[model samples]
Target: MLMLLAAGLLADPVPVYVIAGQSNAEGYGVPHAQLETIDDVTVVWPGRAQKEVGPLQAGWGANEKMIGPEYGFGQAMQRHHQSPVVLLKTAWGGKDVWCDFRSPSAGDFNWAEQQMKTREEREGRSRKVGAFFNAMVDNIEVGLHQAQVHLGRDDLELKGLVWFQGWNDYCQWPVEEAGSPCGRGIIERYPHNLKHMLCDLREALNDTTLPIVIGELGVHGSDVPKSRSGWALRAFRTAQSETASQLDHCCLAPTASFWDTQATDHWECHYNGSAKSYLRIGRTFALHLLALDALPDGQTLKWQASQKGLQAMLRRYPPKSGGLALWGSSIFRLWERAPAHFSEFEVTNVSFGGARSWETLHYADETLFPIQPSTIFYYCGSNDVNAGADAASIAERFRLFSELTRDRLPHTKIFFGAINRSPEKKERWAVVNEANQLVGSYCETQDGRTFVDLNQVLEADDGSTRQDMFLPDQLHLTERAYEGFARVMREALEQKVQSP
Candidate 1:
């Protein structure tokens, strides 16, 4: 048994993919089959954590991007690789690699454009240097830091980095010519600018050997008329293909397939891909990143079936069930784990499996908000190690949960439990402990909401060891530990019931 355990320690971790870029890369070109589910993956909204009912934000914001809330690339990679594959997505909408995402409103190229415009007016030529390059380095550095918080203190062995940009540069054709953010006129110099952007990104990340999948821009066919240069949007596809040629780890994925296959309005930019095309975009991207380049000889993907046009937009799902819970991979038989009292409550164990906060909050509605569970519990925050989020996020999550409880189970009392402290797991996990304290304080101020002290129970009376609570990895829980949490939760619920 000792030898077997030692051998298992040598096994490699599950592959994980990281994706970034501008809005198109963030899922703008191809919205999911439903606005909520992208590529058969669900978007876990963050708001449901507290009590207010609001729209779900795509990708990770306060919380790290989990494979569940973002069940797209992560799930597909895990399935194809036949192992767990965690996908870390930090793409920003309308954000250029050449701007500061920390500022939120830093995409103000108008300032950069104005300086360049005045220079051009004075010198009769485009400015020789643009600040886009330096700005991108900051973004890349910040992005790397954010990834590091979730990734352990080590050089994360990255498998792939999906690229869905160049539109900003391509869009410049019209913008720089028209002198605006939109297509005003055509600037032939823009595509070359895109190449510069790509090189700058590769250099900044020092990731020359990493595999990258480039996604082309797609219009819903109702783009501005240009029987000639008007359709220059299509040329972006060619440019992406060209960028892939120069980069050893780069390849291109045509996104016209993200279009709606059901033949909805071709004018709708979101539903613009055929289903087969969408799957290909997802599957082939994963395959190439895994070094399966020889399969596609002339740009054809080997999917279970071929899809074309509007007919491809149709999608199907295995109906929701209660028989078995879903793991992060969605394909693996996951070991159940949590912060406190997961098994004791049918509160839609939304903590693990990295879901969008919104998805985690609302998951119970599909599971057992009304059917069972007197109070809901959620605890996850290490994802916010940097870019410091305020109590507003904790408040927002609590507010959403409160609202959801009122809507689903009006009589139900919602309890906001603090995130637990990971003693010796990843160093960044310490950040989650700080956020958890805030959550505890935040919940105490609420009326129907009660903040439970999970830490006190897990820790020894003197703040020492409750050794049974955590596993050897320090990330997961031991069976006795899960049961201990549940037992303590039962006592808490009993107290709540007696109080009111």
Candidate 2:
């Protein structure tokens, strides 16, 4: 028996993929029919005996009838790799990133500590931070070891991680509670905490550049309305994108488009608990992993649109003499819908949706220099801060942008728009204010530059943004807000243009 076990332990290791998160990762999918099975794939999930290992199929959830992303993910991996695969899944329902899965390396937040204390009082146990993180790490380790022992092979390679979470964090706490002096909520702290979690996991696993695929929390489909919760969700989603973009060997799988409202009896946002929804998400996750695997070392996957279309647009609509250009992120993109006219000067919109300050720096040649507008109206940096960048980093990026503009268009009048206050980022207003100050200071130093303040019009007396001025997502402005923005922008531009 010992000789046989030794031989099995020495065999080739199988590729293992670990999936961790909250309820979505645990899956609520109710399969319509018998789920397909992959012979080459196996799964180890938390069970009555700490964990249970079985062939990859639909019954990985708490109940045997339920399924999650793992089912489809395993099938997809088997098809692509054509070898034995192991999936280790560890997730709990209603867990937030700020506390439940917070990484050990990310120092404790007072708000999270308070919540932990509350829970401790109620449950009569001292709950530690990173509880889920610890459980996940331990389970993955145990699952892999068990797989090695059961299969008699020492070759179980940990290939990747699939994270599908955030809804809990978005809904658990109010944005006001995340404000300074108290501490930040999970939504505000997500990107930084997520980055820390990724780093910590990689370090623990002894793989510095482990591949990771983060799934977007898409309970409501693509057209997320502007509401308090919608605002929080959008913030979390933006953080997910930024974390993936900044890290190496990482990719993001969008799931909002796959949501089916009529499928399940549960919450409409939970993809209606549709098995098909989970399956599609899982397949997409696997595909992204495969794509990442195909990339060369030090090269990260770019999930966003390429700059080719923007470049083509620039060529098609070259800036006319005395033209004006509006550039920034989704804020400017939405402004394109406004019927406001620029009769005094031709206007061209060179903005892209979901653009960050760093992205603006990179595409300056295509979006900025070529247009060479007489005046430029800019509104960005919110996404950068949402993506975990500090005020200093945002200021540095803006400084670079300013330098670039001066170098290319010395005569151009640059109007730096202060990053707007939003209900989604109520807790982060200080950072926004600091970034605006830096940007304003930078503009003042330039010969033909000025700063436009939107907070005066958008922010309420209590410092909270006016809810009526924004849509359900809370980040994007309402039509009314845009009108206000237009007035401010036009007034500032007119003043600058008329100045001696």
The CA lDDT of each predicted structure is 0.44, 0.75
Clashes of 1: 38
* Model 2 stretches with alpha carbons more than 4 Å out: 1-13, 46-51, 110-126, 173-184, 297-500
RMSD per model, one decimal: 20.2, 19.5
Worst 10 residues of 1 by lDDT: 324-333
Please, what is the TM-score per model? 0.40, 0.57
Pairs of residues clashing in candidate 2:
8-152, 9-152, 13-155, 219-269, 225-472, 226-471, 226-472, 226-473, 227-472
**In model 2, what lDDT does residue 247 have?**
83
- Per residue, candidate 1 scores C-alpha lDDT tens digits across 107-183 of 33444445445645777754323343454455445544444344332243555677655544454444433345333
